[model samples]
Target: MGGPPGPFSVPLRLSPKVLLIDPVRMLPSLLVPLVGVLVVGGFSPRSYLWAAFGLVGTVVFALIRWATFTYEIAGDRVEIKRSLISRSIRTIPLERVRGVDVSTPPMHRLLGLAVLKIDTGASGGDGEATLDGVTVGEAERLKPLLLRRARTEATPTARPEEERHAEGVPSERVIFAVPRRWLLYGPLSGAYLLTPFALAGGAVGLAFQWGDDLGFGRNAAWSVGEWLWQRPSLLVAAMVLLIVAMPIAGGVMYAVFNWDFRLKRRDGYLVAERGLINRRSVSLESRRVRGYEIVDGLAERWAGVVRAWAIVTGLGDSETRGQLLPVVPRADATAVTGDAIGPYQAELRPHPPIARNRRLFRAVFPWLVPAALAGLLLLLTGLTVWWVLLVVSLVMAALGVPLGLDRYRSLGHGYDGDRVAVRSGSLRRSTAVVERRAVVGWRLHQTWFQRRAGVLTLTVGAGAGKGGYSAIDVSEAQGRDFPAEVTPEWLAPFLNPPPGPHTPSDPPSTG
Candidate 1:
């Protein structure tokens, strides 16, 4: 570390602890190479020397990297200088800074260090610049200062402090904090259900490999198989144990990731903090937030829980990038989102009845070909299996009826005040509400069948979130008119042009 020569001009290296953290991070990558060396050495203790050599190399590389890399906030940009043999410099403009993420991995947390990531909203190159390890205090200090300067550069006229004081508002407000009970909603969302299976699969593979190395693989496998074969009931018991373990594992994972999750409004930013072993803090510019999305996975919806994400312009596409609320009750999600971005109060206008037919047709269409094939097979072969296949296909196609109806029921769009909202999907239903000003363009899509059905899909193109939201299978007129209604100044002129100059059919020639 070095003292600033001017305001923030002194080049400073990462904390010394980074040397330790970097090696620990590289440990996983070293596993394959270390194992190969052991295999080549006939699994003898002599291979330990080769492993030690590789570990030393990793340390040396980390040390060189630490010695070479230096960063500083100079003038209007953050500069990163590296390379001893051939110098290289990378600069990120302060005005482009949209968010700052501070995270502490387990190793860093133990050492009281944090990692700082500066998000500049670039679509390429990991979308952020990372400082491997810094003192926790330094990270905390850097986050606000960097964001404040960036916010200042972006909007010179805005005075967040003055505005708050003028309105007699507190500087900080707690928006939402996850409750312990909400962790149960995790398994319902089905996000982490496969985690236990994945871990068990890897662990089983490793265990068998280790047994093989010990020359007991066949004995162990035969013993387990013989034991299970002797007690057939044990198989059913094992299945039941697995059935119970998956949800428990999913809940555990959800708790770990979302432990102590909190969302707060501080100054002019939305700050989120969460995680158990690897703590994370993300600070996003409030002004860049254009909308909010309330998502309902099928099971989560049935359980009356939902998650919310901030539709922030330039937010990264990472898993937790713009997450605002996680697996909370519908009421809680609604309240938090309402307070963050302006509330979405518009009552959605459902699509015309004809759209329902379209949805049902689309849902069942794919199954029809397979069902027909099965029917033909059964007729040609007169086989019982083909008959079963035919029956299964029909049943599957029948299942699509309810799915299509549910999808149609989910589709709707409405606009209220400065916000437009669209809802769609069945399995992972999402209701996105975006500010009118955030919408950059409008698109109307009509397939041949959609046109024949007198409906079209209206895509609302915005600069945030998934970039666009569609009101599927709406009336053609509604699809064309919705954009004009939402952003009249941008689309009305082209869509609803002033009466064209009158041209008489025969009178022009006569004149």
Candidate 2:
């Protein structure tokens, strides 16, 4: 990726071990014939011969695939060519390279092999070009070189590991990693809700199948029903224990999925690596990072922590889900998030407020209407605990009065140099900070009510993370001038940044 030392080309192939380590890709063909032999114990000897033939053919196909797959580095581009049934060749220019991710599954680590992935900022494209079974050192060396070459910069001479820190190269200085205690977040992350149901589906199916095998089909059902009535208290206790166990099960699964999660800021890229069984590593260009989304769900907000994810283009859907800062304290989330995307300050400074009437109307119309209707129904029907229900409903509605006021208080958007930041939300709050240069366009929305109230929803669309973030319910006057203020070209009529020369950004830290 260092411009290839002139116009020469070098072709590379996967390490030999991939034919063994990656046999999972070949499993479907193998499994079909194996299953046939299991079903055909009554059939002739030809069944055995066919199974043998199938195993041999699967191996032959795998070896052929390994032999034909090759990637080459040339003067200006990287080329990958593969042949299985037909031939496919892809050429990616060095300048267009957006990310280089290196991942090592457990087997790959045992054999010291890794897969290096390259992503270009194009939609509907295959996520990356993968070179499987490469050595760890090669992946480490190539990730940064790919980004540097894409920037058309000269490759710096390699230095010792300890001395390289000051070179502004993306070296291994850990930014944020999952702490052992962070496992607390694991239980709250749908462990109780989804995990138990998933567990029940598989468990109930297996239980019925075993009951049928044991000739206890109807008897098993009757026994459980009989026990529920006979030992009601014991059954209730068991149910309580099961309910308590679900989140723990979910938390364990979550820990396994995100075990050993580590994040790093490289010279010109941000890298993340996580997973226990099926491990993955992702490296994204810092230059392509448009912004950061500091997200807090109700539980996360209660814990006073937030998660951060990169808002970048051409990275896979998974990375956009905030692998950058999976779960960190609010302070760390802010500092690391700003570093991930260049020149951001995740502050809570005030911007223009939405009209007070909007909040007032929202509080009354949405909350009071439903509460009043439900309360009236309870009264008219004379339902049990009708008075209690009425009280609870009114309390909930009254709570919204303050919530509406807080929602208005949280509404703000401002600029710091070329970056525009917006903070909005009441329950699950988010502060989205994006660079002005990254803004591709603006989307303005006004409902009949919003129009009458002099506020509008201004969505800033960028090439990165989920494509857009809204500056919800800003004053119409501010919404009209917002784009021009952030990036003049985004507005049709523009007073472009008072014609002045711009200085270059300093080299970012290797945090």
Q: What lDDT tens digits, residue by residue, belong to model 1 across residues 99-200?
A: 888999899999999989888878533456888789999998777667755334334433464257235454777788888877878888787987767886
Clash counts per candidate, in order, are: 0, 3
Those runs of model 2 whose alpha carbons end farther than 4 Å from true positions after fitting are 1-10, 25-37, 40-54, 123-126, 154-172, 188-193, 202-242, 318-322, 340-406, 487-511
RMSD of 2: 8.6
lDDT of 1 at 95: 70
Q: What is the lDDT of residue 26 in candidate 2?
A: 67
Candidate 1 to native Cα RMSD, angstroms: 4.5
Model 1 misplacement above 4 A: 1-6, 42-48, 123-127, 150-162, 165-170, 203-240, 379-382, 495-511
Name the top TM-score candidate: 1
C-alpha TM-score for every candidate:
0.87, 0.75
Candidate 2 residues 108-219, lDDT tens each? Answer: 8888888787777563444567788888877776665566653444235222322343354436556777786786677654533467667766786767765654445767
Report lDDT (Cα) of residue 53, candidate 2: 79
Model 1 pairs in collision = none
Quote the positional error of residue 230 for candidate 1 in Å.
12
TM-score, candidate 1, is 0.87
